[model samples]
Target chain A: MPLVNRVKELRARHHLTQGDLAAKVGVTRQTIISLEKGSYTPSLMLAMQIARVFEEPVEFIFTIEEETE
Target chain B: MKRVIIQSLSSIILYILMAFTIASFASTVTHSLAALKSGVFVLEFNFLPFLLLIIFFVVWTIYSFRTRPNQQMGFGQWSVRMTEFSEVDEREALITAKATKAAYVSFSISVPLFMLTFFFYPLFQTAWPTYPVFALVSTLIIANLVYMTTWIRAYTR
Candidate 1:
């Protein structure tokens, strides 16, 4: 994924388990893990839902990585 | 839990009935072929097996229709509801799509190989009359299995 995310850090800050965060966001725990691992990108709605769960802007949690090239 | 059990039971029954029907038909065909070879062209038509097959089909159809998801309780509706309830979220969906793509690529490669085998059967003498059909079915089954296993493992991790 070209986008970087601090989902793990933010989730840790909120003291929420992956399952808990997933439940809050109305998704599966595997989705939360994938988000943290950067193996999968969330849809706009999912991104907004995750951001809402963390009480932060979507940009705060996810950012586009600078292209080294 | 009860619903799950019932759904599982119905699926099992349906598959069992299908297998039984197929086996019976195959055996009947074999018997007919043997009789033809012996100069006895008499063909026996067993009504009981056909009747049983029809009854099973009707029962299964009704069961499936009754379980469907929606305001009305039907098998199709129930299955739809179950699928929606168990469907992977977006992340797993992405993984599943990738796995499916991989399976399709594998299938594409296999198709040419199957065609070659079919065309070269006379030269190689390795292709039995039914080999091509069985090979095609096997390829499809393997591809689906690969996709399912890959996605399931990815999602679980």
Candidate 2:
């Protein structure tokens, strides 16, 4: 299974640049970029912070896709 | 900015001192090795290199502590922050890890092949010195280069 995220979509909806969101969340822009790209998974604290920034639940931001046999 | 400049200068000085110390030690080691090869037992002890290494470490510690992101941050946290700022971020770290794994896999496969080739070298009338130290160092360098290149490409593309 792979994790998918709506970080890029949410950022666009909020009219926020990756750098803007990253600054608001006290992280580097590259971390946001990685989140959007689904290359790195954020910690629980980071996920909650990001969710707060977007005013959404963590589940709304990230989801896991089950592998098909 | 001023502090950064001072830190940079100090770092440069420490680096130069370390380099000089290493060079001197290398020369001494080479001389000793040559002497040993010529059936001469000449052992000399020099503590300059060790002292320089300690000084270099002290300089690094001072610089790291001075440039730490916050007073509340512990040394480990400060070190992580410094590395994150100077080196890769999350994405690059992930890519680097993958690249390193791939490099290790290739290295494992290649080493035995290389050894087998060396084993067959005498049959081919080829004379080569099987220096394990040199071979190991070169392998490590090549593996690191491969990992770096792969990591960079993965991120850039």
lDDT of 1 by residue, A1-69 (tens): 288898999989999999999999888886888788887778999999988988999998888887322
Kept native contacts, as fractions per model, are 0.58, 0.25
Summarize candidate 1's per-residue lDDT along B1-157 as a digit string, tens digits.
2333354445444444554555456556767898999988766655565677678768766665565433365555454543212234666557657667867887988778777777767764532443544556546655655565565666656
- Per residue, candidate 2 scores C-alpha lDDT tens digits across A1-69 of 778888899999999999899888877786787678787787788889889999999998878866222
DockQ agreement of candidate 2 with the native complex: 0.25
Q: Which number leads on lDDT?
A: 1
Per-prediction tally of clashes: 15, 0
Q: Say which candidate scores most in TM-score.
A: 1
Q: Per-prediction DockQ, in order?
A: 0.46, 0.25
Residue B88 deviation, candidate 2, in Å?
5.5
